[model samples]
Target chain A: MENVLNWITANQQIIYIVVLMIFVGIEVIGRVPSVLHTPLMSGANAIHGVVIIGAIIVMGKAETDNYLALVLGFLAVILGTLNVVGGFVVTDRMLEMFKKKK
Target chain B: MELNLLTLCYLIASITFILGLKMLSNPATARKGNLVAAAGMTIAIAGTIFLYEQDGEKLHNYAWIFGGLAIGGIIGTLAARKVKMTAMPEMVSLFNGMGGACAALISLVEFNHLSKQLAANEVEISAVQPTVLIIVLGLLIGSVSFAGSMVAWGKLNGRVKDFSFTGQNILNLLILLVAIVAGVILVLNPGQPLLLYAILGLALIYGVMFVMPIGGADMPVVISLLNSFTGVAAACGGFLYDNKVMLTGGILVGAAGTLLTILMCKAMNRSLQNVLIGSFGGHKTAAVAGGKQQGAYKEISLSDAAMVMSYANKVMVVPGYGLAVAQAQHVCHELEKILEEKGVEVKYAIHPVAGRMPGHMNVLLAEADVSYDKLMEMEHANDEFKTCDVVLILGANDVVNPAAKNDPASPIYGMPILEVELAKTVIVNKRSMKPGYAGIENDLFFQPKTSMLFGDAKKVLQDLCAEVKTV
Candidate 1:
């Protein structure tokens, strides 16, 4: 555990960039025109569902006897999974209808 | 095979997420954009499970992992397939809340593990300040998002009414201060599990209280704000674990969610602070409803409206939440086609906040197979309305209300609205003279040139289509 912390401290600069990169990324994408903003918002809602990975990682490392950690970790995975799957699927359903004029 | 490869995979996934978001700017590529991001998430998750190792131990809890995934995936699939278009906002809120709860739980679980280490003297608490900071952030923000989103879902679902009393804002502030103080204490004393639990409880309560007073009308902005909260919380989890993909995904979601919330606030002419603290949806404004029409409103028959629509060189159809309530979008599309068949050009004028959420009307219209090109945003649509021969407003009220444009005393004053009044002839199709969702009378309904066609939007448009065919 201490080793991971040391590694993180060493790579702090990279982590900050990764975090800041999202803002730069959106600025480059520009304002999502109002017509597609709902889908965009919902789609972005699903993208954050990737936090389930954190849940999985934490659960894997938890001591087998630590039931509290295990339960919280398991529930986190469940909820996160729901967010990712439901969010993307619904966003897709809405976006597919946006067809150009025939 | 190495840690470097794992980081590389995460970087690739993050890039895909950004690419997907960029593609979402246009309607034509939004679906494929979602798919691309989904693919990136899949890779990020898969790579972490397979390649990530710590202290020579690899993750082996397959049963718990697969069980959670399978159940969650099934529920998500069913919900996505069955939810109505009008209920999309609530669904998004529900899912966003789930994601937030997940982040909070992760922070809780990690904090517990860390506390155990501290108690065992396996590690010094002082050495983990950075991790502690991230954990508290995730715990605080995630709790707020989770609880706040649940309230938003209730309001959107009509299960929860806006609750307000005197000094509510002060109470909310007090609770927030208590949570922040608890968070600070937890940072200083990292081994205290009870303090962590207290912060969690207080933050959750604050979340509920913060949103309970906000009216249903402010939900789009609240939902957007909560969505951003979940993103930042998720990013904290990423920072805690040093997972590049999680960090990148969290940042993207965070930035985009903030942008969305600001856009919603701008559309409504409300500041974010007002949406958060003003209780704009409370009972203060409830008494203003149930008043009689102040001026005379003229009602038009189906034939007259159809005649006006059919002979017009250019017609603009303005739809609102009432259109969705009547399930009239498809029928309205039929009216547009019939008018087009009569050599009248048809266009849809969409307000920024039209329907239940931003871009909601476009989704409804798209479901009816309305061509994307026919959907004009508020700015362009307002410009076109001046040259339009007729404006056919389908159950629309506040968006086309003259109050938004000319009345300084109106509650919706200073808000940008569609300029349907500028058209040569204005025809509003409504069930009756009742006010719109905003609970305000539309002055446009009483204009000399404005004639109201009273009926359910679906039935009225159907009758209008029939009349147009014969006219």
Candidate 2:
């Protein structure tokens, strides 16, 4: 972990510049077509689904001194759990809400 | 000149997300777009994990986190399995609420983190400029979405009335005024205790103001709109963290949410003003009395209507909330299969705002694993109804109402409708011919050739299918 932080510190400038370019590239491509948006967006939303997993990772990083981090990590876990459970249920329920009437 | 590989991976994932979005713009390429976006999401998660360093503190133990994940996964799968076809709207609303709530909660935590740093003089006050501002806005809007979406879910589940609160217009304006006052105070004194409480209070009020007035019929549209708001809020949060994936994901949501909001407006035949400002979300209070012009009732036996639909060469089945209440998708599916065996071309007409949500009809059919090709959207099948040998309408109303286009006096005037009135032999399956959720009688029901099949949708569709096969 220390090694990775040292590496990030050393390359912060370059990482910043490259990430900026990536943002610009994304904006340009997003404009060229519209239908592709849903797939891409869903992909993004699904990725955000990882916030729960990320919360777990954050929890793993927490120490006794980092009380705020621990609390936030736990909050993230709860919210993320809700996201995954509530999201799929809502999707299914939303789908089922349309059955034909007799 | 060194560059972190994890950051590079995040960039790559961002690119994939963009490409996936570009491809999704067209229906033919939608599947590919979805796959590419999924890939981007996977790459983003993988990259973030690699970049996340546990430098200052020991990582929390996996016990609770992993257990929670497992529990969530199991519950999610079970919930998905147990969901009825009619429960999708409420489910979607619930999910939207979670998404919005996540952003709100994240921003709140970030707020506390930033404030503590300022108190300790750990970071210069000026350092909090754009990031802090963006995060605050995210928190405010996310809270609104969360609260509003919950109301939408409640309405979808019939837990709340379709009507708005009394003095809804005035209530909305007062909430906006309070929220604006809160915002001003926050900007002037970011550290003030009163300002923080005001922001929380106003945000909660804003959500109720936004959602309270919307009618039940518009719950799906409201859910879609909130879904967009959540995206924008997340994007704002991304800006706070300077995260590439958050930015890209936020933009995707912004675009998707905008499109959905527009489509929803079209479905309701409403301008954004009607939904957002004019209390158009509420049901119409004043319905004209027909002044004793109520048409004579002509009820028919279910078996008799079934007999008529039995020998039809081509059939168009229109399913609505009636079918949902009866839990009749399986019977409808069976009826279709039976009709097909008897040489009838059975096709289903799906209204955009059918049942309780957008694509409600399609979802119902899809649940039955009805062929992907069997269901046709309104525009494609409206004309087909003309040539259709029999149009079996299963427990639907409002969407198929002809009066919307023809009768100016009708509450639904100028609204788009399914052209089921064009069908020659129309068979309506209804438990009773009550006014729809919108509180309007269907003109198509009173048409010359139209006959009501009184029974449960599942029973009627199944019995009709059964009898049709014998002929």
Best candidate, lDDT-wise? 1
lDDT of 2: 0.64
- Per residue, candidate 2 scores C-alpha lDDT tens digits across B16-94 of 6566555544545545655665566556654554455434433445565566556655765576567665675665566
* Whole-model lDDT per candidate: 0.85, 0.64
Residue B253 error, candidate 2, Å: 0.6
Question: What's each prediction's TM-score?
Answer: 0.92, 0.82
The true-versus-predicted C-alpha distance at residue B346 of model 2, in Å, is: 2.0
Model 1 misplacement above 4 A? A1-11, B279-293, B466-471
Model 2 segments more than 4 A misplaced: A1-69, A81-102, B1-3, B22-32, B53-74, B277-286, B289-292, B466-471
TM-score of chain B of each: 0.92, 0.89
Report the C-alpha lDDT of model 1 over B1-471, residue by residue, as the tens digit.
667778887888988888888888776688899999999888888887788888878886767888888889999999998998888899999999999999999998888888878888999877876688789999999999999999999998899998878899999999999989988888888877888889899989999998998878678888988988898898898888877777778888888888778877887887888777773434444454334347898988888888888889999999988898898889988988888888999999989888778888988988888998899988999889889999988877888877877767566778899998889999988888877766777778888999988889898888888999999
**lDDT tens digits, residue span A1-102, model 2:** 996687589657545644554454345344322212222222333333433434445456555476676666666656555654555334324323233344
lDDT of 2 at B452: 75
